[model samples]
Target chain A: MEVEKKQQCSELLQLVIDGQATQQQRHELDEHLPKCECCRNEFELSLSIKEGLKSRLKKPNLPSELATSIQSKVLELA
Target chain B: MSVGESMPYKSKDKQRVFNKEFMPHIDAMYNFAYRLTLDEDDAKDLVQETYLKAFRFINSFEEGTNAKAWLFRILKNSFINNYRKVSKQPNKVDYQEVESYYNSESVDEKITTDLRVETVQHMIGDEITNALNSLDIDFRTVIILCDLEGFTYEEMAKILDIPIGTVRSRLHRARNLLKEKLVNYATSMGYKDKRK
Candidate 1:
């Protein structure tokens, strides 16, 4: 792939992965992916990373006592 | 719109508003604090300090608006001003510099090959968290705000006090850095052809 085309593909890869891409941009990437091996690899990489983040990085739970502590602390300041 | 401006500052009223608006977000605040500090004691102290500040400046907050965002701004500022001083790693990059660097040609070239998809394909949650924690504070903050907290780019920009474009670029860089860190794990796991 040409350098500029490769760059364009790279930009689209981020937007698509981030869920920030527009419909037209997604369409453009979908069209480009099949014909280009490099872009496909890049796209798959981006997708896996995003999925990994979402599935693995569970939200940290707050300790049971933390909320009451915060509440009392704030009230003390009042 | 301004908090406690229209309504008189009665103690009972303040408590009511505090309970309704501010208290519900404790989990989120705690999570954000813990991620930033990476220590339970420090995170608790940070949250306590954040609440103290928020209550002290409750009058400044706009009522019925994004209290979560407002509290986040305070928490982030407190982390930088107080925690960062005691902590070892201070943010060294001027965001303007990062923005300019991303605008440059090097970023485009770097992204093309920096992330090897096969390497991180099999990473588990703990490994991913480790990768995230390994990042610099700025990069990690973006990931936490966007990926972990599900803040919109606009919300992240406001919370982090950067422009929307900076949020996007920083998030992009953060993810790529994470991918680099997890590459070894993915490589060891062996890339399965799951795409078919």
Candidate 2:
């Protein structure tokens, strides 16, 4: 791909991955991805990364007492 | 009296809003604070401060508007105002420097990370968490907001006080930086990139 074309594809790829792509843009990317190995790889990798972050990252336990404490404090202020 | 100006709320209504709208997002708020501060005690203080401020200014928050985003905006601002200077994270990189560097000539260069999708899928929670935590705070923030918290670009733009264009670009840069870190971790663990 030419430099300009690649940059445009990259941007469109991001839009699609982020779920911000317009329907037309999504169609355009779908048409282009099958023809471009680089973009297909990028799209897949980016999606996988998002998936990993959502599912694999550990959520810390919110301190059990913190909410109660904040509630009491808010009660005081109110 | 700009938009989002505080409206008059009865004390009863304020309590209602605080319990119904704000309290539900406490877990998310705590997670965001922990990610930003990367410390337990600080996260606790930051979240408490945010909630108190939220209650004090509850009138400004319209009832049906996005409470999560509004709360996030407050927590983010509080983090900047109070905690950033005393951040335990050493050698914080300036956001301006990172932004300029990412926007320059190398912006288009695809960061080569030697991690396959399979490897990324196989990564444990701690590996992914460590990779995320390793990023500069600004870059780390976009990922947390978009990926973990599921904020839209518009909401993110509002929360971070940046333009929509900046939000898009920053998220792009942040994801690539994260990918690089994940791939580096994969390589260190002897995972191979089948594509390469």
| Top model number, TM-score | 2
Model 2: TM-score for chain B: 0.88
Instruction: Report lDDT per candidate.
Output: 0.77, 0.85
lDDT for predicted candidate 1 compared with the true structure: 0.77
**Per-residue lDDT tens digits of candidate 1, residues B1-196?**
2446554557887788888999999888998999999998889889988988888887777668888988998999999998887888855667677666555555444554555555565566888888888888999998888777777788888998888878887887676667667764454556544453
TM-score of chain A of each: 0.83, 0.94
Model 2: lDDT equals: 0.85
Assess candidate 1 and give its TM-score to the true structure: 0.82
The best candidate by DockQ is: 2
Q: What is the DockQ score of candidate 1, to 2 decimals?
A: 0.51
Model 1 residue pairs with clashes: B119-B186
Residue-level lDDT of model 2, residues A1-78, one tens digit each, is 676687678789888877888999999999999998877877888889899999989998999999899889998998
Q: Which ten residues in a row have the lowest lDDT in candidate 1 chain B?
A: B187-196
Q: Which segments of candidate 1 are over 4 A away from where they belong? A: B1-10, B94-119, B187-196
Clashes of 1: 1
**Residue A78, model 2: Cα distance from true site in angstroms:** 0.8
